[model samples]
Target: MKEIDKIALIEIKNRQILHVRSKGKLKFYLPGGKREASETDEQTLTRELHEELSININTNTIKYLGTFKAPADGKADGVLVKITCYTAEYTGNLKPANEIEELRWLNNSNLDIISEASKKIFEFLKQKGEID
Candidate 1:
């Protein structure tokens, strides 16, 4: 089994989660990416957020949300993605940047359009009373 280690930002507002779709992708996902060598979770998420969303994640406000594992989207069977998620305050207008093509705020009702890992996240958030 192959596991992809990724860090993600969980930005929820008014019961909606901020999700992004990369260029040519069909599924929306949490904003983040794989951890670079020698980078901590905070550093990884901060850099990824800046690159993908044109925002600066305030490290001081970073809080661990949870880790989710699911079949890696667009990958072969037996491959899994382990997303380590964090909620943090950020500065700057959220816009698609880098490889991101669009951004959307999503809730549980939109489950059919998100990645499997993201579905797990939405469920977790719902169970915690953080979203509908």
Candidate 2:
């Protein structure tokens, strides 16, 4: 089984979580991407946000949420995505940049539109009373 490592930022506000839909994709996901060579989780998340959303993440405010693993999106069953999640403060207006096609705020009701990994994250947040 191949393991893919990625970072995700769990941006929440007013009981809603931020999610983005990639171009040509049906699922929405938390804003983030794969780690670059020798880069730390924080670095990867920062770079991904800048590239995908044109925003700067505040590193100091980043808080580790938890890690989750699930079948990689659109990949073989044995392929899995090992995601490290964090919550952080960001600068700049949220907009769809780069390959992102749409940006939306999701609550519990929007779980079906996201990936399996993200659905797990949403459940975790809901259990902690972080999202409505």
Candidate 3:
């Protein structure tokens, strides 16, 4: 099995979680990406969000959520993705940048357009009553 490690920021509001659609992609994903060499999870989150969503993460507010794993979307069935999630305070308007084509606020009902790992996240949030 292949394991793809990544970090994600979970920003939910009004029953929706912030997501993004990258250029040339059909699914939406949480606002984060793979960690670079020798980078901490916090540093990865800080850089990815800024590059993709133009936001400044408030390092002081960073809180670890949980890690989720599922079949990697669009990859072979044996390929898996592990997403380490966090919640943090941020500033600046959310905008698509780099490869991101658009921003979306998604709920469980929108699972069809999300990655498998993201589906797990939706179910988790629903169980916690964080998203409807």
Candidate 4:
């Protein structure tokens, strides 16, 4: 089995979470991407933020939010994705960049439109009373 390691930023505001739609996908995902070779978690997150949302993450403000795993979406059955998530402060206006198609804020009711991995995060947040 192949495992994909990724990082996700769980930016929450007013009980809503930020999500981005990929250019050729139906599901929305947390604004993040895979880690680069020799990059630290913070470095990977900073680069992904700049590339995907045109923002800069304040590394000092990053809070680890645990990790999650799920079968890799749209991939073979034995493939899995391991996601390390963090909540952080950021600078710069967010805009759809690179391969991003749209950016949206999602609450509990928007679960069906997001990817399976994100749904797990949504459930976790809801259980923690972070979102209603």
Candidate 5:
């Protein structure tokens, strides 16, 4: 089985999650990306957030959320994506940047529009009563 590893930011407020759409993509995803060689998880996530949303994440304030895995979106069958999530304080205006074309604060009703890995994140958050 093929596995795609990624790191993600889990920023939730008012029972909603921050989701982003990459340019030309059909699905919304949590703000993050795969780690580059030699990058720690925190470094990877922090760099991804800044590149995608122009937000500087406070490395010292980062908290490890849990890791979740699901079928990799847009990949061949039997491929899975493992996403390690973290919540952290950030500084900057949350605007679409780099490959990101749009951003939304999504609730459970919009789950179908997100990637499979993101669906699992929402499920975990919903079970914790983080979103309706």
Candidate 6:
């Protein structure tokens, strides 16, 4: 089985989680990306948020949420995406940058529009009463 490791940020506001769609992607995903060579999770999160959302993640406030894995969306069967999630404070307004085409705050009702790994995260946050 192939696993794609990623680091993601869980930014919630008023019970809605931030989701982003890449320029050519259909499913909205949590803000983050794959780690660069030898980069730590915090480093990846900080860099990706800045690159994708035009915001800086406050590394000091970073907290581990959970890790989720599911069949990679739009990839072949048996290819899984392993997302390591974190919640952190950020600076600056969120705007789509780099490869991001759009940003949206999503709730449980929008499940069908997100990736499978994101679905796992939404379910986790919902169970914890973090998102509606």
User: All models: lDDT?
Assistant: 0.95, 0.92, 0.94, 0.92, 0.93, 0.95
Residue pairs whose backbone atoms clash in candidate 1 = none
> Model 6, residue 29: what's the lDDT?
97
Ten residues in sequence with the least summed lDDT for candidate 4: 108-117
Better of 3 and 4 by lDDT: 3
lDDT of 6: 0.95
Q: Give me the runs in candidate 5 sitting further than 4 Å from their true place.
A: none
Q: Clashing pairs in model 3?
A: none
- TM-score versus the correct structure, for each prediction: 0.98, 0.96, 0.98, 0.96, 0.97, 0.98
Better of 1 and 5 by lDDT: 1
lDDT of 5 by residue, 16-90 (tens): 999999999999999999999999999999999999999999999999999999999889999999999999999
76 in model 1: Cα distance from truth in Å? Answer: 0.6
Write the residue-wise lDDT of candidate 4 on 4-30 in tens digits.
999999988899999999999998989
The true-versus-predicted C-alpha distance at residue 115 of model 6, in Å, is: 0.3
Q: The CA-based lDDT of model 4 is what?
A: 0.92
Residue 59, candidate 5: Cα error in Å is: 0.6
